[model samples]
Target: MTLGALMLVEYLRKDMVAHGKIGLTMALYSTWNRGSSYPRDKVIGLLGIIEPRNSFKPEYSWTVEKVYRVAMRAAIAEDGNLNCLGLISEKKQSRNKNLASWVPDFELHSEPFRDYITSLSKVLNKWSIYKAFMIPGGSPDITTDEDDSVLILKGFCLDSVSVVGTQAPGPDFESVGETDPELWRSSTRDALNQWRSLLPPNDIYLTGETQAMAFWRTVLVDLNQGRLASKKGGRPKRLDKSDLQDLLQLETTDGMEGLLSTWESCLRPIYRQLRLIEQFNRRFFRTESGYMGLGPPDIQPGDAICLLLGGSVAYALRKSAHETWTYVGECYVHGIMDGEAAVKAVEDKSDFTEYRLV
Candidate 1:
C-alpha cells in the first residue's frame, strides 16, 4: 500500500501495466470489501486514478484533503478552465436543479455541487456521474485557495441529449426492497438473458477484462451499499418484468438507439423503477426504434453513445441539444465502449453522429 499523495510509485506503474486500470481498481475495491475502512475515492486515488496538479513533487503530497479540494474545484466551478480529466456517474451529479432519486440529498444539487460540475465538465468536457475520478498526470492551469470554488476552464454547454437513460447514483435496493425473492431472482435472470441476446454472437460477445472487472466492482459496490440486495444478512433490491422495459430504446418511449431520445418517458423517471425491456418482448413491437445492442441496464434507453476524440473508450452522454449539441456525464455505454460498434456506426453513417463535445 502507498500514500495517495504519490499515487503511482515507479514499480506500481509497471504493475498497473500488468494489471490494467480495472484490475487494479478491483484489487483496491476488494480490499475495501474485506472490511477495510476506505472511502471509494481514496481507494481509486491510491490506484493513481486521479488528476495531478501543479508540481509533481517526488514526495507524496496529494493528501485526501488536497485531492478532495481538486475534486471540489472540478465539481463546483467558480470560473472557467477548471482543468480536470476523469469520469463521473449519474447518481453523483446535480449541476442543475436535478431531483434526487433514492435519497434527496445524495443525487440533488447545491450551489457548490452545481458550480463544481459545470466547471469540471467545461474543463474536461465530459459529465454524467460521481465525485470526479480524475486521471492523474495533467496539471491545472490555475491555482487558488483550498476552500475556494475553482474557476471554469472555458465552459461548454452540455445540452442534454434530448434523450437520457436511467438517472444516476441509482436507487439503493435495500431501501427499495424486493417484491419477492423468487420473482426477483427469476426476473433478474430473465433480464440478464434478455440483455445477453442483444450482445454480439456468442463467439464474439466478450467485454474487455477491464470492463468486466469493473462490472464486478460495480456489483460489489451495489452489494455493499444495499443496491443489490441479498435475502438474509442483506435485502436485495427487486424489480418486475414490466419495470425493466426502459433498458431498450423502443419506439413507444421515443428511444434513440444507443443514445437516448428527446422524449419525456425515458428521461422523466429517476431510476426508481428497473424499467428495461426485453427485445421482441411485446414492447419493441410497439416502437419504431430498431433493436440496439444487447442493451445494458446502466446504459438504458435514450442515451447517446459517443466516441470521444481522445478517449479510447466510448461514453454514453445524455443528449441535451440539437443546434449547439451538448451532453452530460460521459458514462459507461456498455455495447459501444468497445469501439468496433462505434466505428461501424460511423462507417454506416446511419446510427452515427459527429458532434463537438465542448
Candidate 2:
C-alpha cells in the first residue's frame, strides 16, 4: 500500500506539471506515462478538477486506495456555490456520445476517461454517506468492498435551490444611441423583468460572480477576521457598491425598481464571459418553484437543488426513480444558499440516503 501510494504520487507530480497544473481524471491517467518529473508546483490543485476515469484498474496495479488518493486530491475544492461546478467539456469525444449521467460532468470533454467517472462516482457516493445522491438515471445500488479496496471521494454536491444565469443588458443597451435615453432605459427595464422571472419574486437571489461580495470582503475581512457573522450574514450590509449606493439614496423605491437596480449592477460581471451564460442558465440552475436563475435547459419538473457536505453551492439532481438520480448541473439558490441552509439541514437531522451513482 505504501509503495502504491508513492508511485501514484510520483506519477501525479509529473501529471500535474505536464498538464499545466490542470486537474487529472482517472480516465486521463496512464500508469505507463508517468508525466514530466520536473517543474513541480508542489500543488495538486482541487480534487474537483480531476475526473475519476476507470482506465486505471485494481489488482493489476491500481487499487481502491489509489481511487481514494484521486478523491483526496479533489477534496480541497470546497465551495458553497462554486462558479465551476457541474462543469462539462464543450469538446465532446465523438465516440463518448452516450453517458447516462452516472458521473459528475466536471471534465472538459464529454467522453470521460473510459467511463471511470462511473466507478469513481460510486466510491464518492459511498464515502459521502449522509449526503449521497444519484444523478437522474438508472444504476443499481452496489456496495464497495473496502477490504478489497480503499474507499475515497473526489467531490460532492451542495444543497441548492435555483440557478441564476447572466442578465447582461441586451444589445439594444450596448448600441442604443443616447438621443433617446428613455428608449434604451425602457428596454433595459424590460430585460430586467425577464431576468427577474428566472427567480422567485419574493425570494432572494444569490449570484455566482460576486464582485460585490469581494468588494465587501475588503472592508469586513479585517473587521471580523474570523467572525462567523461576517461569513454568514446576508446582503453585505446594504449593497456597498458606490453606484448602487448612490442610486438607492436618490430613489428608495421598493419592489421592481430596487430589484432592477440591484440586477443591473450585477450584469457586467455576470455577463463577463459570453460562453458561460448558457452553461450557467441551463445546467447549473434549478429550483422547486420553476426554473429560476438561468433557463432554456430549463429546470426539469421534479428537480431538487440539494447541497452536499463538501460542495460549493446547491447541485440540481433529478429523481428518475424513488432514489435514483442523475446530476443536472450546478446552481445558485437564493435564501438557504448563503452558506447556511445546508448547516441547518444537518442540524435538523436531514441526512441524505439516496445517492447511488453507477
lDDT winner:
2
List model 2 lDDT by residue over 1-358, tens digit each. 3332343465466556665453333223322122322211111222234543342122323332343333323332321112222332222232123333422223222221211111111121112111222222333223222432221122233433544433323322222222243443465555444443443444332444233332222122111211122232111232335534443222233533543443333234222211111221132233544423332243554565665544434455666654456555544343333445555555677655545422
Every model's TM-score = 0.31, 0.40
TM-score of 1: 0.31
lDDT of 1 by residue, 65-105 (tens): 34433443433332222223222323333322322111112
Model 1 residue runs over 4 Å out of place are 1-87, 90-184, 190-291, 294-301, 321-338, 341-358
* Per-residue lDDT of 114 in model 1: 22
In every candidate, how many clashes are there? 60, 35
- Deviation of model 2 at 195, angstroms: 3.1
Per-residue error for 58 in candidate 1, Å, reads: 17
